[model samples]
Target: MTIFACMPVFCAIPTTYLSGSAAAGGTAVINSLALPGGFVSPAIMGWAKTTTGSFTSGLYMMAALLVAGGLAVLLGMPARTLQETR
Candidate 1:
């Protein structure tokens, strides 16, 4: 769960930094090619200027939360059934 929760923060740090660097130089990195031109181009430029970072980071964070929550639910299931039996 801890790892799951931290995955977003981990991915975000590098993604934000690299995007900012690319935008500042007005050059695209190979990874940036995967990003949508209309949406991500403007977003990366905005993030570079504002230092606010990527929406993808937020997505990663949400995914981490979901993974952590799912793990928690799975871990609790056995206890839940035990209580029901009692």
Candidate 2:
């Protein structure tokens, strides 16, 4: 729920610098790439639960991945103004 709530803000991060066909193509590519993870992660979480016989580990793993993603955004993603990208 929180993830979906925050998606618009995150989505805006990329869209702000793109326009016209570039923006459309970039959005298409981003959705295409992101789709697989949406499918794969639940299966991975289910596997983790099955092997461990508890959902705790799976939840922890999800939390860890969330932290890693946050860190990636903070450390790896470069801050660029709209003018910079263009």
In every candidate, how many clashes are there?
0, 0
The residue-by-residue lDDT of candidate 1 on 1-86, one tens digit each, is 86457545534534543566654443334236435545855655566555645566545655665577557644755665547658
| Poorest stretch of ten by lDDT in candidate 1 | 25-34
TM-score of predicted structure 1: 0.32
The per-residue C-alpha lDDT of model 2 at residue 12 equals 69
The alpha-carbon RMSD values of the candidates against the true structure, listed in the order shown, are 15.8, 3.8
Residue 61 CA displacement from its true place in model 2, Å: 1.1
TM-score leader: 2
RMSD of 1: 15.8
How close is every model to the real structure, measured as TM-score?
A: 0.32, 0.76
Q: What ranges in model 2 sit over 4 Å off?
A: 79-86
lDDT of 2 by residue, 1-86 (tens): 86787678667655765888888887787789779988878987899989999988988888888788768766755555434667
Cα lDDT for residue 28, model 1?
35
